[model samples]
Target: AGITGTILILGHTDPLFLRELLEYRITQTVIDKAHGIQLDAAAAQAGQIPEVHLKIDSGMHRLGIDTRQPEDAAAMFALENLNITGIYTHLAATDSIAGEDIAYTRRQIDAFNGLLRTLQGMNIQIPLTHMQNSYGLLNYPDVCCDSVRIGASLYGMGSKEPHKSNVIIDLRPVLSLRARIVMIRTLEKGECFGYGMMFRADRKSRIAILPLGYVEGLPRKLACGRGTALVHGRRVPFAGLVCMDQLALDVTDVPDAKPGDTVTLIGRDGEEEIGIVDVAEAAETLHVEILCRIGQRVATVVIDE
Candidate 1:
């Protein structure tokens, strides 16, 4: 990966962090809101200002200056020390293919363009401009200015349901999670399991205890037989509620399941595989949410193949 490009700091610039960025000659950054004069002062101290990209709130109503306010745009551009090299806006909802949401996204695009024209009217020439996130990159590719910020798509996830992107790139998942069975036990037909006695063995069943639980980022909904794990190339259901640091799976069907055996929470095991989308659907959430909420207690390993 021979890439040489500046990383965009998505949040408000802190003075201390700005100083370090300046020291490292990092030139690209997005100014989401007014950060007082400290930002300019820091850049001035470093002998040159960064190529600042002004973020306008086209309709997201989150972290950006209102595009309706021309004064805000002018004031930032007028800063003698900083160079307004780019202007960008975030899309609120680009996943809606039709109706009000799509119409609203169009309105935001119009507003963003208007803001660009307003800057141009004042003789301010921003060399680069972009307003697309992953959804916009897929749906509004023709509206691209200078560049598009593709976030989730880079990780092989789509913005909409059905898990297929409009973009032609053949995307593949880059991350997979796995865990090991730590213990195994047999439960009587009438025996209860987990907190609150939420689940009970319908018959004599074998349970495999895993070193992972909701606290380790697995959703509790996945417990109580709602989710399944791949053990010995077969799907096995959870025995009961997910605990804080551990969970139990009904491995009765797989007689080979043992303490040292590996369990695939989300990855390939033999001929079977569990994907992020499958886990997200089981948790009733988005894939990104599932990935983000993975607890810090779990270790991570990166693979290139």
Candidate 2:
């Protein structure tokens, strides 16, 4: 961390004591700022230190000091007590499934490069240049700088396999989403179920209700009025509009359904598996967006079998 006086800190840790860990960068600039901090001064007074890094917006435009204004860069250097270590940007559509946004991705990279040129004229040296996110690492290798940061793949998720010479490691999914059936109704020839009366009985049907629904992140787009679920090793189309806390599926074929029957919302039953990607394709969206929006109310069960 000290070789460059920059430590990428995530979450909520104070930067005051960080100076001590910057073993390689003990320059006076860092020492002075470390001591100047009002960080419970009396306690840290004995160990005042200051090696720091500031985030400059290259193109992400999400967080960091927007360098669009030269003053933003100037304001950062003006902080006499700190050292600017690195600058980075996040590409917006590098992971596009269509791969049609290559131009946009390259444009952002060019913008960041422009910022670097602008800073160099002002005598600012940005030691680390990183832009590649998981998507960037996979589809836009040109954006990888300093190091590559990976996330979705760490837990075995929707990352595209990169064609890089370095073998990409495959991670295992650490979670499984499961649910239980609350009730099973015998649908008479004219019965209807769920919100908006979306599912009408097509011939005496057996309907099973699961205590999970749109509230749990099931795509409401299923309102095309057709959806399905995994039931007893078979696929059952949803009978109607997915509700807030429950959904109904036609389980007539799965004659064994009962109040206590366990259902697989996103797993395999026998030789059938319902992955989120399949669900996303059906809903016409990327699996990443759908996974990110999964409601917090659902229990995240970690199982190994």
Candidate 3:
């Protein structure tokens, strides 16, 4: 369990590809959890094991076993055949010095540590501890012990403030979204565009259509949210509503608009670049979700280092 914990806790998010449809990867997280359970069971049967940790959810309410619920935590600890390890919790801002929210996390940490103390009172020999995240790692070294889980930091998203880490790190964004202009059409004044007839041409317009649509996960819910596109090295705006298998952009301003010109939807476009994070901001999501939800059939060309 210690070795397994080492593998995961120390593992950085840049390498842990989060494509949920990757069944093998999904199987691995589950298998590792099950393996922990089995290892505990074996140790309990032998009665020679020292300890293990139960990740407790004190407040943030995402992952972790419920330490506040003694029954739940105890049941998790009392796996058919294993010894209990230390208990750990996650603080929302164990790193940030924000406000009253910090107090809740403090209470959570105290509660989790208290839970460990209670288990010790029951004579459990659990060892190791944690209440930290990447931000916590930067701000609070106290949480660093036998192990600490660091995500996003390794990718150079190291801090919540500006001027955080100018030191270069070897991390890369593994996602890219793109589509090519498949056709071109000229729209006269008063002509409508796309479904719902929401957008009408105020003047004659030349629109370039790309072969990507809302069905490809190109966020249809984003109304007038504006998608970034490149035409002849100059970025142009999507003119009207995005539809399935196609999206229209006003390419009238483009110097040489034509069909079959490769356009960058979300990637480098000259010195003025576009990133998935930029797209996510327009689509109302984080870079994490944007990276995770790259559409199927879209080429994920991994340019190896």
**Which ranges of candidate 2 are over 4 A from the true structure?**
1-71, 80-86, 97-100, 117-129, 147-149, 159-174
Can you write out model 1's per-residue Cα lDDT over 1-305, one digit (the tens) per residue? 45478666666767667767666555545454356255777677767677667788899998777888877877877777777667788888786576677789999999999988887899877668888877787778779589988877777766446333444555676767789999998989989888898878889989999998888788988978888899989999987888889999999999988898889888778988878889989889888788887888889787767
Can you give the TM-score per candidate against the true fold?
0.86, 0.70, 0.68
- lDDT by residue for model 3 over 60-102, one digit each (tens)? 6766655665555555555654334345667775545555655
- How many backbone overlaps does candidate 3 show? 6
Better of 1 and 2 by TM-score: 1
Model 1 poorest ten-residue lDDT run: 159-168
lDDT of each: 0.79, 0.63, 0.60
Residue 15 lDDT in candidate 3: 18
Highest-scoring model, TM-score: 1
- Per-residue lDDT value at 262 in model 3: 84
lDDT ranking, high to low: 1, 2, 3
* Candidate 2 structure, TM-score to reference: 0.70
Cα-based lDDT at residue 77, candidate 3: 52
